[model samples]
Target: MISQAITPRELDRRREQLVDLQRYLADQEREYAELRRRVQGFIDRYVATLGPLYMELDALESQLYCAMRYLHEALARNGLDTRGPDSPKATAMPQLLVLPAGAPLPPEPEGGLIQVGPPPLKTLYRRAAKRLHPDLAPDDAERGRRERKMAEVNEAYATSDRARLESLLLAAGESMVKVRGGDADAVMEWLRSTERAVQGRLRVVQAHIALLTNHQMHALGESVERAEKKGLDPLGIMANRLRAQITERRQELYIGQRLQPESSLTEAFLRQREQRLGGGLSAARAP
Candidate 1:
């Protein structure tokens, strides 16, 4: 249930609440942007120092994994009996299943891909564009001002930035308000709609803030801060860890190179093939 009539005091309170929520949401958004910027700065610095080796390692690992999977599938398709006496199941296998380095990897088995925006954001953008399109302005000067605002709107929509779109819509709405001339019922209706929009935008902003604060990169940044407090270089530590893995992998590959193909290559191929097939079966069986 909702009230149809509104007192002056209630309208004022709603106006103040809307303003406060907008300000708080803006501050939160700025804080999130700053945090993201700092995280990216750290990543850029780290990459500048170790990017080539890191990329090479990643490529090598991916190539190896793909080749192994391909060989396994080929063998199974050919009806090869892998459970024979000389199979990998009867031999000692080396630790070839190395885990990925600390850096984030792209999600696997990618399928669904789409561009999506919140319904509220899209509605606000449509409404704002209806009211603020530069071509609709009466005078050249006003048109110029609207042209600039329209640019902002276009950029916000391009990025699917909900906060920026909401702010632009609020600003445009406020500018159209005539404090002295409107009918009371019309003004009240406008107030109700504005209140709903503001409250809806505030919820979106708060959810975005929550997501940013709890993001993996944000958590990593906090970890780095904690490490700095103890006089440790967290980025350097990560670099050293990756370097150590690279050295170990190089050594393993070197040893594999020296062995006969029938020995190391066959063993590695069989082992990886078994693991792949077994994993597929296990996943199929999962509840």
Candidate 2:
């Protein structure tokens, strides 16, 4: 809403602040893009190297759990499910399902989209240079200010910082004689709205940058890089651990398969295993 008219100095200050925020927002976007590329690179490599191994491990786990369930049901048949009939039933156990090897795992869900508004205005520096070239200055004092401001615009243009050039143009325009019968208030309102839009976009970029920094992929990438710097092979180490686990699971399955479910030893083994696996049956299925 329109209110008291603002002094030129106050208006220039606000425009300068808006331009600074716009430049910062641009930097944040670049940082986020670079970070995403780095994190995704790590994830792509990790999935390619470990995806199949994980699937195989999961399959073995499913089979092992299914065997345990079978043995438990067998015990129930013989009235050995628990100490008494009042104990929890076998139906209370989680259901473990085996998935096909070719199934693809779903990616981690993301939050709302990043809402960056219109692109930066370009070629404004040339216009600013033509208008505020300092040669057009009427006196030494004004010429010096014009030269300094023109230098700033040149630097902004070189770096593709359009906001800086635009603000300098508006600031320069503010010092000129008023145009006849013009709507300065409406023009000022438009600039204020533009500032608000840019501020909103800056906030969105900042939030997204924070999100990317906090993501698990970023942590994983850091750890892997740190390992490499130390001359260690983290990926190989992970693969070795998984291989070791696969070997243990295979041994357990082998012993379980050979033992008769009716035997006392089989009952003891199943009871001990009951302590190990915990979580939804759905947890057993993943890429």
Candidate 3:
């Protein structure tokens, strides 16, 4: 059923594509890691210069966003969807854990709700693990293959990535069939299945690269790079922006405290809300 001339050419092409994709993915990952390091370094240096107010302001901004999110969710739960039809879905805000200058960064999130993947994902992982456990392999080569596949399986399960789990299953099944089958029909089946599995993985890797390159943070990094090219201090620019925000927030808090004696809590809250809204509208309208 399979043509011999086309099979070798197709296989070689696929192999080249896979290698290229893998290398590009590796490069993208390295670039992203470097960007994160630069950003973190800038933040650490800038925050150290600002003393405790910068950290306090950062915490206040986080709390305000969380409060807004909670309010929106509560309203939706009560069937009061205030969001317009064209409004984009709310993205979960990033929460930075600001510690003292010498304090260690917090551990990664794990266990409890964070560790709970979907039931079907867990079931798939168990099935794949049972079949592909490296301990069950009879030879070193097969064991190595199993080890790599098992790592992928574990990662997919941990992330609750159903598509990746299914693709791995399909790839594993194809590999098993390719090893056991010898007839023409079986060879064709193996070729087709293997191609599909590779293509599926290619799509996933391509999408991941796209996401990394198109991320807002990555764009910000690009802007910083451009500013540096023009001999501008990008870090200083960012620090100035942060300093302005902190000053404004501190002024608002000071105003609130001054009004506290003359106004009730609800009245004070309303005044703060009005000030924020007016400030936002004015900023939006400014050239």
Residue-level lDDT tens digits of model 2 in 1-287 = 11257555555676577668778867877886787777778877777766667777877777776776676667667656432111222212111122112222222112111111222345355557777899999999989998999889889888877656667766767321121112335445655766677667667766767877787777877999999999998988888887898898899889887787679797667655654543211111112
lDDT tens digits by residue: candidate 3, 1-287:
23444454554465466557556655655565565566555445544545454566666555444444444344445454432112223333222232212222222222211112223556677778887999999999999999999999999888988778877876677332222212333333444554455455445545554655565555665686798899998767656776888777666555543443222342334335545555321111112
lDDT of 1 by residue, 1-287 (tens): 01347455565666577668667756765775676577666556656656765775665555444444444444445543343222222112111121122222223211111111124556667777887899899999999999999899989988988678777876776322221112334444655665566566556656655765665656776787799899998878877887887675565445433544345365554455446447321111112
Per-candidate TM-score against the hidden true structure: 0.49, 0.57, 0.40
Error of 2 at 265 (Å): 2.2
Q: Using TM-score as the measure, what is the rank order of every candidate, best first? A: 2, 1, 3
Runs of candidate 2 with Cα error greater than 4 angstroms are 1-4, 7-13, 82-182, 278-287
Error of 1 at 78 (Å): 11
Q: State the C-alpha lDDT per candidate.
A: 0.55, 0.62, 0.53
Error of 1 at 116 (Å): 40
**Candidate 2, position 283, lDDT:** 12
